[model samples]
Target: MMGFAVLLHVMAVVIWVGGMFFAYVVLRPVAAGQLEPPARLTLWAGVFGRFFPWVWACVGVVLATGLWMIFAVFGGMGGVGLYVHAMFGLGLLMMLIFFHVFFAPYGRLKRAVAAQDWQAGGKALAQIRMLVGINTLIGLLTIAVGAAGRYLVP
Candidate 1:
């Protein structure tokens, strides 16, 4: 059960963070250079339309598995180390940022695309880009904390 939890947790993290990395780093630049506003925005909207559902699933699995490990396995927060705390806090922050992106900007982006409002879509995309960038960095940090916490933390 513990192994399963860890596996699910790791997989969810990989999909979520890796998706953000690929989209922000690899896809964004190429799309911007090659496609015009309408196509690029549409492409992004399409991409998000496909990807966000996975993110939602990842978010659910990550949260559930993390908490399960924290409580069921380790006997809750008191049993965890400083690194675990850091990881948890960062994960929560990332979740909050993702929620904002999904609920606020992503919603706007969809509406703008439906209305063919490129400017509004652009604005929404810019917001998502910035937030995703921040979340990616934080995700990386969280991974580091999870990976190195036992060794480096208290």
Candidate 2:
């Protein structure tokens, strides 16, 4: 049961973090170089439409499995190490950032794309880009912490 919960948690993390990595690192540059603003915006909107739902689902799985492990396997917050606490804190921060991005800039991006407002879409996309960049960095750091934390954090 513990292993299963950990597996789910890791998979969710991989999906969310890996998606952000690809979007920010791989796709963003190619899209910007190849496509005009209108086409780029449309492509981003379409991409987000497909990706965000999976992110939301990943968020649910991560939260549920993480909490389950912390409680059921590790015997709750009090019983966990400093690394666990740090990971939890970082995870919550990442989730909050994601929620903000989804509700604010992402919402505006979708609307702008729908309305064919390239300028507005560009602005929204820029905001999403910055936020996702931050999240990706944090995600990488979190992964490092999760991987090496047991040995490092006393």
lDDT by residue (54-117, candidate 2, tens digit) is: 9999999999998998898888899999998999999999999999999999999999999999
Q: Clash pairs of candidate 2?
A: none
Candidate 1 Cα errors over 4 Å, as ranges: none
Using all chains and alpha carbons, the TM-scores for the candidates as numbered come to 0.98, 0.98
TM-score for candidate 2, please give it.
Answer: 0.98
TM accuracy, model 1 = 0.98
